[model samples]
Target: MDIRQYLDSTYLKTAQQAGLSDAENVEVVKAAVAEAIEENFKLIMIRPDMVAIAKQMINDAKSHVLVGTVIDFPEGKSPLEEKLAEAEKAIAEGADDLDFVIDYTAFKAGNIAEVKQQVVACTRLGRKHGKIVKWIIETAALDDHEIVQLSALIKNCVITHLCEDDYNHVFVKSSTGFYKTENGKPNGATVAAIKLMLENSFPLPVKASGGVRSYEEAVEMIQLGVKRIGTSSAKAIAAGEAASGGY
Candidate 1:
């Protein structure tokens, strides 16, 4: 299979997170953008701050790789206005996809209204601008039931409040690949979580992120109905080799 097209080649680390200087981190992001262009991956997922850089690089290269950026990132605790503001800036910076980290912690805290409000607002904001929107639930932090509930929640929010055309534009994504779980458990996408998402978020599509580090794993996620696979190891996975990376 042409696995590269299904991959969202990703690099979301900050300077401090990667233990590098700001300039050095930008260099790393530049390298990743170049690699995605060379490999012809579907998109390059990055932090919002790097959206302009990635967009400029891809445009200069005349490559078709789309630029995606995170909104609210690993922590989705930001207020709805803050999330929308970040997304607006990313869109202005030429981001093609806006992956917003859903307020999963709020959802877990029985703040369903907060979660639902942001989901609808963010999804509409991205879709209104013709940008793809993916809601990352940080699945590793939740139980199986929460995964299913949250997936259904997103699906319902789109279908109930948005137009039918928006359904295909919005996605229920699996993880951020940055969540730290107890006892070193897998902090990214798992078969169980993906299955729950797929089962609950049908017609809206699902993107499996995190913990998928090999070509086999990518293919497996596709086989299970994921429309996209986000990973830092997209290059190695495309080569059919096992990749070594935290994501």
Candidate 2:
């Protein structure tokens, strides 16, 4: 993807290095994100815990970088109210975008109605705040049919409401860094799901995440039509430094 077109300088829980307290972790994340911006990163996805700090960092920076926050994070089982609260809080903290993890449990259990309801709630809330919402489907856990169904649902919600155009607002992301295949790669199912989103002309972008750590893989994802990316390896890629030992 050429690194800049679709990169969310991500700092998920899994991306945290070991042995740092929450405050220290926030500092580390801020430094990393600052570096990412200096290198021309377009987006920065910060954990909710780090939202306030991230916002401050972005404000102090000389360049403009889109700031985002994750809602319902790795596990999407939080109550709808909680998810909405998190989204609102993030927006209030100056996040320009919201990356919400869809309720994978409900979707996997075939509770289609509940799944849509949760996503719709977050999407509507994001709209109210004038913030872009990117639904993280955790596609690694979904079968092909479910992935297609989710894509269709997002399209319906966003298009029916006449939200912002594709490039300007909203997106469907593929994972939450919770699962990977046996080969230590991000589950292929997530990539497949993103591909489905692309083929269907969904009005939102697609963010590929979880286990994306190298330049080759990043380029491959962009080639696959991923418009956004969530990765902790942004600094290395920007510096043209390959992942240690070829990843």
- The regions of model 2 sitting more than 4 angstroms off are 14-17, 164-168, 180-185, 188-191, 244-247
Candidate 1 stretches greater than 4 Å from native: none
Lowest summed-lDDT stretch of 10 residues in model 1?
238-247
Number of the top candidate by lDDT? 1
Instruction: State the displacement of the C-alpha of residue 141, model 2, in Å, after optimal TM-score superposition.
Output: 0.8
Model 1: per-residue lDDT, tens digit, 1-247? 7899999999999999999999999999999999999999999999999999999999999999999999998889999999999999999999999999998999999999989999999988998899999999999889999998999999999999999888888999999998988988999999989999999998899999999999999999999999999999999999999998768
lDDT of 2 by residue, 164-196 (tens): 553347788778776555656455224566688
TM-score of 1: 0.99
Question: What TM-score would each prediction reach against the true structure?
Answer: 0.99, 0.87
